[model samples]
Target: MIIESYSFGRMKVDGIGFDSDLIIFPEKIVSSWWRVQGHYLQVRDLGEVLDYQPEVLVIGTGYSGCMDVADEVKKELEAAGIKYYIEKSSRAVEIFNKIDSKKKVGAFHLTC
Candidate 1:
C-alpha cells in the first residue's frame, strides 16, 4: 500500500483519506487505531499487526513526534523477532512510500 500524504489529524493512503489513526496491512487498512494510552504505544496496541506476523513494523509517532513507544514494547517486538522502525508521521509516510517488502505493516498516529 502507498501512503500518499500525511498531516496532523489526517492522512491519505492509497488515495483514501482518514481522520482517525490507522494501521496498514498488505491487504487492507485498519482505519481506526487507538492505543490504550493515547500518545504512548504498547505491544497490545499492535495485536492485529502481530497476528499477521509482518516482517517489519513501521510506526508513525504523530506529526511532531509527540507519541512514544515504550521500552517494554520494543522488547516484545525484539523477542518476537519482528523488526521495527519509528519516526515522525511525515517521515514515516516517506519511508512507507518507498519501502519494498512482501509483508510490512504501518501504524500511523494522525495527531499529537
Candidate 2:
C-alpha cells in the first residue's frame, strides 16, 4: 500500500483517507489499531505483523513521538530478522514512502 500523506491525526493511503491509527501491509490496511497499553508498543502489539513475516517494519510513534517502543520488541524483531524503522509519524511517512520492499509493514499512531 502506498501512504500518500500523513498529518497529526489523519493519513491518506492509496488515495483514501483514514482518521484512525493503522497498520499498512503490502496487500492490505488494518485500521483503528490500538496498543494493549495505549502509548506503549509491546511485542504483543505486533503479533499480526510478525505473523505476516515482513522483511521490514516501520513504526510511526504519533505526531509528537508520544508512543514508546519497548526494547524487547526491538530485540524480538531482530531475532526474527526483521529490519525496522521507528520515528515520529511525519518522518515515518517519508521513510515508508521511500522504501521499495513489498514485504514491508507499517504501524502508525496518528495522534499524541
Candidate 3:
C-alpha cells in the first residue's frame, strides 16, 4: 500500500485515511491497534508481525516520539532475523513508503 500522506493523528494509505494506530502488512491493514502497554512496545505486541515474517519492520513511535520501544523487543526482532527501523511517525512513513511492501510491514502510532 502506498502512504499518500501523514499528519498529526492521521494517515492516508492507498486513498484511505486512518485516524488510529495501525499495522500495515503486505496483504491487509490492521486498524486501531493497541499495545498491552500504551507507551511501550514489547515482543508480545508484535505477534502478528512476527507471524508475517517480514524482511523489514518499521515502527512509528508516535507524532512526537512519545512512545518508546523496549530493548527486549529489539532483541527479539534481531533474533528473528528481521531488520527494523524505529523512528517518529513522520520519518517512519518515509521509510515505509520507500521500501518494497511485499517484504515489509509497518506499525504506526498516530498520536502521542
Better of 2 and 3 by TM-score: 2
Over 4 Å off, model 3: none
lDDT of 2 by residue, 1-112 (tens): 8888888899999999999999999889999999999999999999999999999999999999999999999999999999999999999999998999989999999999
Q: Lowest-scoring 10 consecutive residues by lDDT in candidate 3?
A: 96-105
Which stretches in model 2 have alpha-carbon errors above 4 Å?
none
* lDDT ranking from best candidate downward: 2, 3, 1
Question: How far out, in Å, is residue 48 in model 1?
Answer: 0.7
Best-performing candidate as measured by lDDT: 2
lDDT (10s digit) by residue, model 3, range 1-110: 88899999999999999999999998799999999998999999999999888999999999999989999999999999999999999999999999975889999999
TM-score leader: 2
Clashes of each: 0, 0, 0
Clashes of 3: 0
Ten residues in sequence with the least summed lDDT for candidate 2 = 1-10
lDDT of 1: 0.89
**Sorted by TM-score, highest first, which candidate order results?**
2, 3, 1
**Candidate 1 error regions (>4 Å):** none
Give the alpha carbon lDDT tens digit for every residue of 23-43 in model 1.
Answer: 999999998899999999988
